[model samples]
Target: MTKHHITLAGAAAIAIAVAAPVALAQDATVAKRVDKLEKEMRAVQRQVFPGGAPAFFEGEIAPDATPGQVVKSNSPVADLTARVDALESQLRALTGQTEQNAFQLRELEKQFAAYKAEMDKRVPPAAAGEPAATPASLPVVAAPRPAAPTPAPAATATPPKKPATPPAASAGKPDAARLALVKKVEIPSSGNEQQDAYDYGFRLWSAKLYPEAQAQLKTVVAKWPKSSQASYAQNLLGRAYLDDGKPSLAAVAFYNNYKDRPDGPRAPHSLMYMGIALDKLGRKADACKAFRELDEVYGTKAPQDVRTDAAAAKAKAGC
Candidate 1:
């Protein structure tokens, strides 16, 4: 029994020795594979993040880690997901800004349309009967109405003598007389009548009756110098002269309107017109100076049309 036990122990020792080398060889192969895998992972990390690994990975491990232990982190995937989220957020912001810009552009177009309509109502058509060579300083004259014939004696001589009465005023009354009366009438202060009178002058301007418009607008300015409509009338008068091809006169009128009421509703319009008139008069330097002054003085307070028109005019004048 003692001899049999010794033989079993020797067998057990030889088997243990054989198993130890195989286990050590397997461990060495596994360690080499882990080192190769770590090198490949580090190469991928360098390619992915040229600047460096993110701060979250700082000081977390030695250059080499022990084999048979797993290193696990969701950081790379989490970082990719966070970057995608940020890109989506930025895209959404840009889309919102684009929508807002489109809305503002639509609103600006609406405002421009309304302003153009108002300007159309104020501008006049060219006169038909105006001479081709009419002087710019002179106002355009409306065609004269035909005269009515005097009554002749009745064939029966004294058959019946009717009472003498003034002829009823007709719709075909002479334009000259109507225009004279328009110039003579005084503009009342703050009433419907005042508004009507101003509207009538505006109608004349729209009809291309420049002489009539000038006369009526001048009367409104003279009679209601302190009224709100005075600035409007003055500005219209300047435009009338400008459209009539009298640039010097238009410049003077526009300057007067701006000088008299720099804060008036029409002041910026007057300045813009003044610049146009100066340009028409071949005084480009003065015109550019006027445009520069307009921006310096009004900044954004000027109407959008005035601002746009000023920019266009400035470009045209090469300012």
Candidate 2:
């Protein structure tokens, strides 16, 4: 009987040892599932709140509720069910929040697009090639005409006499007053037409009448493009603009002179002045390029005065 009792005890001990390993394996499987669920929760949080997870979200999953903690559950299934329920509830909340944020952003974009359309209608775009008309460019409103005097009685009538005033200049014509100003500045004529036109422009430029000089020089270039005076006129036109505080226009004029008449007598002068104009327009790098080009293109052929000025300019520009 004692042997039998001892044998029974040994069998029971073996059974207990086998059960322990199975229970441990089940616990390990549950832990892995819980870890996977936690990782999925974190990924959802990142997608929902791109900036960062909120404070409440960071602390939402209680440490004591984790699978690592000893939960008083009747079975592993019950523990897994509780954990899945919690994750599903949080996931649903995050999904709703993401949808709400996307809706708000789309609505904002629509509102902005509508407002832009309204503004565009109110302020029409400018026509191609034409600048928007400013207040100064608007046409003047004419004064209302007075009612004609009641016609005189036939017995007392006298024929209407013409007014003794000079006829007004026609519309779209050059102003007579401006022409009179041009005529006032006298320039002695040369036998050569090209020379005479350039001399008149030069005289106007010397007198500090930059607008008139620009117009006159343009005329000289237009009328005698093949003449020797064309080079001088183009260079002087650039100088006129430069002296009038229009460095931008001056730079263009100088570039045209050199590009169109490279072999002309004043080509080097134009290139030098182009550099100075670019410098005045606050373009140091472009100025350096111009100076470098002047050296490369003209070398010793450039006038002494131009080379000296270019050297000074390069130093000033730190080139």
Candidate 3:
């Protein structure tokens, strides 16, 4: 015989002998596992599908069954359950690992999509019903609003010796002094923010920057018509006009202010100032009406000093 053939025979003999015992042991283990699975399955089956009543022997010639009939009827429910349970356990162990691996793969895909999004600034946002993002896409920024309007003056009036009054509000290139005043004079906070506007307005008025202050305060009243300070700002704006030698603008301010906030705390002042400003504009009927409104609204509450001063103006204006 050839040396290769002899070697081949030796290896084959060893492999068969070793494989035989191992195979037998594996079969025995499988059988034992199957039996154990059967017992557990039968216990569960009894709880779920217990058959009806048992028969027993009566003492005196009764027609009933004796013990050991469980085997005679070929009741194989426990055996069937055990066989099914053993197969299911093997199936679950094998398939459960594969299912877990699939879940991990899906989670990794999600992480990759998020990582791609963070790096791309130009990518559009995800839309409703849209597919998930991939590495090729990025993010985007939103558009901004139009530029804010040029700030108006705090008060409304013309400059000294200026016959024509310039537009108080400008678009792109606004007046420097007016803008400066607007930035410096923020509308104050209050229950009646209009009144806060007016009070700050008064501080501006006392400073003698009447036109700018009037415009700013007037804006507060215009923006918040319901504000308690609406009338105050309006009336003060009228006064600012009169001080600036513009009776027409003053009349407009006072009239607008009074009409908007009739019961305002500054109503009396508004009415009185409108009468004075209108009287200066040679509008007598308009002036008298304003004076009468002042008298009617502020009967007792009108300060004696204010009434006296208004009375003097009315007499001077022939209202």
Count steric clashes of candidate 3: 18
Best by lDDT: 2
Pairs of residues clashing in candidate 2: none
What lDDT tens digits, residue by residue, belong to model 3 across residues 268-308? 67567667766766767667766766786687787665687
lDDT value for model 1: 0.57
Query: Whose TM-score is greatest here?
Result: 2
Better of 1 and 3 by TM-score: 1
Give the alpha-carbon lDDT of every model: 0.57, 0.61, 0.52
Output the lDDT of residue 105, model 2.
90
Clashes (backbone N, CA, C under 3 Å), per candidate, total 0, 0, 18
lDDT winner between 2 and 3, please give it. 2
Work out candidate 2's RMSD over C-alphas. 22.3
- Candidate 1 steric clashes: 0
Off by over 4 Å in 3: 1-196
Ranking by TM-score: 2, 1, 3
Models ranked on lDDT: 2, 1, 3
